[model samples]
Target: MTALSPLDKLMPRGYVRQMLCFPSTSAEVSHTLKTGLARVLADVPYLLAGIITSEDRKHVSLSECYQTLEDLYSEQDISDAIDYVVIKQHHFPPSSFAGPGIIPTDTQPPFPNPTPVFRTKLSLVKGGLILCVAVHHCTTDITGFGALLKLWASHCRTGASAAAGFDPAWLNRKALLERPDTSNRPTPASIPELLHVKGPDELTKIAALASQPSDPTTGVFFFPQKTLQALKHAVNKHIASWGNGGWVSSSDILTALLWSAVLSAESDPMSDRKGSNTIGFPVNFRSRFNPPLPPDYLGTAFIMTTATASRDDLISLSFHAGSSNDDEPLDSASISKLADIASIIRASLHSIDEERVRNVLLYLDGASGDHPPITLGPRHDGVSIVSWADQNIYGLDWGDIVGTCDAVRLPKLMYKRYPIVLPRVPANPAGDEGLEVIVSFDRQVFDKFRQSWPMRRFSTLRYYS
Candidate 1:
């Protein structure tokens, strides 16, 4: 019966779906997970509660009524969910395989009937198993969802008696909505990131655009440890020359690289003239508070920030200029350009502090009447990036039965323009440690991007739909 925060209400209308793949599959393994999930739900009953929205649809609250375990968990055969050829083609299934067949629920929000806030499905393949968990976005962000998964895994490894000491305070969601002294809070319109908030009509249009079939050129890029080190070294080397004492992390540089490539691919030199393109990313504010929020607090505590740069500056690589071949090495000028882009991203991230976070909370708290959904970035020309690299998704262990997760996947129904940077794959016997990034774009744009200098020099095309 707890009310969700304003920011929670503003989250995109859908379930946050995550797929974990394992090499082993057995009826016993499925039974253990089902029992584990039930135990976790009994300990945290709110997860089994339904979402109840206000008549005006401006507010949402968790329902007091809870559903039974049978209503929330399911088990099915892999052949009923996906083709076996897909499993053979990939050691781990790609994002395309995520669907209602495996999830067994409508992913879109405003459920036609009351449904549990969380649902789990286990699909058994010939030689493996895929566990798909769908948590309503309004209930929690990905970080919170990860915490829940970890808890469930812990319960599976250790008996329920050993897991009984779990703290109840970690489930508190209302802590994020506490209103502090707001006399000095900044106005929503005054925030640079809020400037592009779209009207309801614009949001409707965006929804329409999303419903259209995605372009066939969606795929993933795998960047190995060696490639990532080379990229970080090159970018940091350029920054060190300036002597600003400022630097960017591998995540920052990777984001910048992807942003530049996406913009370059989408830009039409024939008609796209001088203009600025923006990149928007969500910043986790869990630790930015003065006393710092609890690490285990399961709630939505993130806000979006953006960085902008002119098209010419970002697309100055030799390939964009048509002066380089696919096999040509990245020159000093390209590295310098990437360094600048990464710096912009780093600065934007640094701008989100405790004060700004409080200001955003104040704005969301005060919002009333009919207004547009907040825009993460420009509706048409910008890119929105979400990074799961820090989530440690691959580290979740389901005891000796499930082993470690082989790979993680998301549904194609997610916004195509919004690329997700997945956690680095676990080190393989070959000793390769790397990241998998999923991206989608029009045929022409993707074709150009895959052949771009960065793609050729630093990554391998792993999967495409």
Candidate 2:
């Protein structure tokens, strides 16, 4: 049995599901996937292992298990998983594929007995196929998950004997549990990125948030390359005047933009809502290690960092309160406000260096039972933004039979305030490379979000039931 890292134990008990859409259907696709997965398991046997929880259910480990391809792979009619119109339009309508029909239901957490770490399903549409892979979050993070998909695609494209060289060392989970010397450990309070909700009241609030019903109006918004460039340029130009010679990334600007927009849409100006609105985002620490973890090292190597702004400050930055004209240039005050928000995000991420990472690891190492020194969930009124923008999900090739993926979709999240930033799609014929963002909200908030000036100014919004 391989013990999971402390951070892994903190992952929510659930499966991370991803859907890859292909423009062509094939009779042998399922067979190819099964064979490829078998080959992958042969090389990375831990993936086939079953997850075992500790007596108290506070920790988890992987146990070797014998499971066949039949146990993991299945085929169902396309209509059962998604609408036929999705194949024609090449874009999934919001909440259209949100159900569990596409993924393995048994993969959901709270396993009384050990269960397989991975599961897959394939559905063939009229002119296309949808491949769904669900991996337990405790088994790997998104980077590791992407690596598994890429390797699976490789095995499918080339014969198993073709030597799709992959390092088995990357699968070592214990590497993440390693820590610095005792003298170098920092106190838990030193890490501002973490929020300790150990009090009964705070824990109750978090439980309330978790058990809240999910909002139905999840919308997908696409922003083209030009618009992203414009937003970055505007922020960079404003910050350059400070003469500090530092600059913020496009991601920082986009995060600020979305954070402000979402908070604005949910803001009830009439209500006496005070306090800061925080945005928590995960920062990949794979490279922050002294020697730096391998690019393909397969384990969770990130921690959440938060950036906060006063509710009033965020409201002032909201596009809803900006100029009525969509095309009008941002006023000087607005530009400055945006630049400030982006700077806060950039600084918060930059704060997580090797020392801080080690400090967090040491802190979590002491956690037990249901209480950890830190909480990964977003604050009650805050938003959590997870970016898959750098993940190479769209580039996974399944040989000439299926070619490249046409698009990717994530299932509706249980947390309505959480938003995911998907990878940028390849440039279209018009030379526009666009990014897709999925956000969930109730009908009223969704309506306000759809009409928000940022949505009107920078993206095309699509809604579905």
Q: Pick the candidate with the highest TM-score.
A: 2
Write down the worst ten-residue block by lDDT for model 1: 373-382
lDDT of each: 0.72, 0.73
Evaluated at residue 448, the lDDT of candidate 2 is 77
**C-alpha RMSD for every candidate:** 3.2, 3.0
User: Pairs clashing in candidate 1?
Assistant: none
Candidate 1, 259-355: lDDT as tens digits: 7777667767575547777777888888887767776567787878888876677776525446545556566777778888889999988988887
lDDT of 2 at 146: 82
Best-performing candidate as measured by lDDT: 2
Output the lDDT of residue 419, model 1. Answer: 68
Candidate 1 vs. true structure, TM-score? 0.89
